[model samples]
Target: MNILSQVTRIKNAIAEVLTGKDELVELTMIAIVNKGHLLLEDVPGTGKTVLAKSLARLIEGDFKRIQFTPDILPADITGIQFFHPKHQEFEMRPGPVMTNILLADEINRATPRAQSSLLEVMEERQVTIDGETLKLPSPFLVIATQNPIESHGTFPLPEAQLDRFFMKLPSGYPDFHQEKEMLHMYRTKNPQDTLKPVFSLEDILVMQQEVQETRVSDEVENYLLSVVQATRSHEFIENGISPRGTLAFMRAAQGAAYIQGRAFVKPDDVQFVAPYVLAHRLVLTMEGTMRKTKEQVLKEILESINVPVESEAGR
Candidate 1:
């Protein structure tokens, strides 16, 4: 099957369990193709966990969930070394991070020290324990969720850590019709329980390889830089997109194009993914934060910049 067909299959599978979230499903697929982690921030009972679990089930990958808590230790995530009298040697015990799909539920509830442990694994795709490093399975992806409405006993993720996520998304509450549909769908069985894998790990890897090969023309490249540079100079911004953020934006644009069944990146692809890619990376001034959110600032920046015409962007 073609990439678009495969992607559609996976999307439909997840949508069966996660009702009223077509865009969320698409964004999750974009992150998967880009080999990037996602941060789902929303209020409780927004189906964040169900969404992550549904994706895991649809991908046929090994999934693990870590309920992050303030008392959780770094070793609890990266694994540990224990002495085994039977083996007469220290044995390595890998943690949840070793799996292909890791659901870090309530990530912000963990202390910074414990949270930082994920930084290395997320970037390196490997974990070290007892002076030894173990590589994670191919197609590793972290779907971390946090409750934005709660502040009690929660440790906010540092800016540096926030930048690491490719996209920060919200699993908003379902509408009345959708919520009614969900109630009926789950009246007897959990939708997620019946979900079977639609694609294999190798299939995802192939799609990712194709996404990396997706084309970006020079005019589009210049347009991307112009937008990022504008963020740095924007009157209400304190910090702008970094060089790393620029690369991520490019990759995400390519992923968006791939999802649309296009071999080349278009201005619309960049525009569609820009807010999600750039919002979390930005730091607004105190006045700016009080007046507008990062998404609003990013939207203004996007509007201020000129989008390359199709002829130019396709050049």
Candidate 2:
């Protein structure tokens, strides 16, 4: 099937399990097509773990869940080499990070050392063992979920670690109608039990390539940079988005365009993806943090910035 069809199928399949979260599903798909990882922050029982598993099932990829605890070690995630008595040789065993879809449940619960171990694998897609690097499987995606309400046993994710995630999302509760439908659907069995694969790993790789080829005009590029620049100068923010954040915003826009079945990106594409791509990367001022929400600050930034009008000359 084509890229657009594959995207739609993936979205529909995920929606089957997660009702009334089309926007979140679409952004998750965008992160996949852009070859980026996702960080989901929400309360418990919001289907955060289920969402990650459903996406893994939809693509028919190898899925593994790592429960992050205070006592979890780096070797637990990256595996270890052990000596064999008879052969006088060491054997290497791969950890859950070797899988295609990794569900890092309660990622914040782990120590900084254990959490930092994921940095190389997430960014470089390879694990270093005994000075030798082992390559990970193709289409490697990490969907990490953290509990937003509980900070008792959790260690907050540092800025360096947070930069690895392409977008940070929140899986909120469903509406009354959707909740009613969910109750009706779950009466017999969980929806996840019946969830099936919608696409293959090869199809996703193809979509990723297509997303890279999606047209992004100079005007849109300038507008994206301007928005990032605005964040730095804004009094409400102490630190704005970095250069890496700018690239992420552009790539997300391209992904959004591709999901819309368009080969070229539009200004609306950038607008739709700006908040998710840039919000987490921002460092709010003391006053803003005390009195305003990130969503409110993001809205103010969007409203204050001018959206550049593209000229017909480029078209």
Candidate 3:
């Protein structure tokens, strides 16, 4: 609960600029606490870039931004080795990925090779250049933004890379009142300017450890697995949730429980986080897509599974 207060401060601070999206904010925080990266898939001018930057500013850590483009090279993000004339040696230079918070803007616009540069660092938190590997800073998080409406000069992210993201969220347009408030605030000054850091990188690292410590009862754990397994046997799904995704779902459930001041995860915790955690990882059959979206398919999976009783859930 003490951690809840700190995280609440962070959420409220970010809400100043990202109006009317509290659930999205909560989900984003969950991703952070679980040490998972995010992919923001939405149309332009939906505050995707602003959200990424605000999150970076909210934590006391190094922040870096990379604008993904067609010409971007692998070395541009993961770092490069350059020859030093005076030293007569090749010096390894760290790129934007070396920072604590990285905002990968319009990531889909980059070539696949350039985008693939992030795989190692995202999964292993280390970058290799010229046969030398360097560990990235602790609490490293990548909040990547992509415009779903644009296709020209953009390369689609492969399924392997997509699975790396813990969640793919949409930054939808704000409601009327929220938009009005945003306009009023923008007339005077950017709301993000007044934002301040509420927690430190060290705090985040500690909180991440706490999230993993959150308990999952045997029945609740089985329920979670049942949902994942259903995805695999579903008639419409070509590929179901991967083992990595199964682990991600458990981690996300733990984060959800921690946020709600609970020491143990419940079936509700898994239900709340399952859709976001599983949607993108699925490879649907063409018939499935024609009948329903990935979200809809996931919804069916959740509905079909029997949730554990309260007694079984240790509630």
Cα RMSD to the true fold for all candidates:
1.2, 1.7, 1.4
lDDT of candidate 1 over 19-131, digit per residue (tens): 78988888889999999999999988888878877787788888899999999999999999988999899888899999888999999999998898987799999988978
Question: Residue 8, candidate 1: how far off, in angstroms?
Answer: 1.6
2 against 3, candidate with superior lDDT: 3
Clash numbers, per candidate: 0, 0, 0
Candidate 2 vs candidate 3: the TM-score winner is 3
Off by over 4 Å in 1: none
Report the C-alpha displacement of residue 171, candidate 3, in angstroms: 1.2
Instruction: Give RMSD (Å) of candidate 1 vs. truth.
Output: 1.2
Would you list the C-alpha lDDT of every candidate in the order shown?
0.89, 0.86, 0.88
Instruction: Assess candidate 3 and give its lDDT.
Output: 0.88
Provide the global lDDT of candidate 2 against the true structure.
0.86
What is residue 279's positional error in candidate 3, in angstroms?
A: 0.4
**TM-score for each candidate, following the candidate numbering:** 0.97, 0.95, 0.96
Candidate order, lDDT descending:
1, 3, 2
By TM-score, how accurate is candidate 3? 0.96
Which model, 1 or 3, shows the larger lDDT?
1
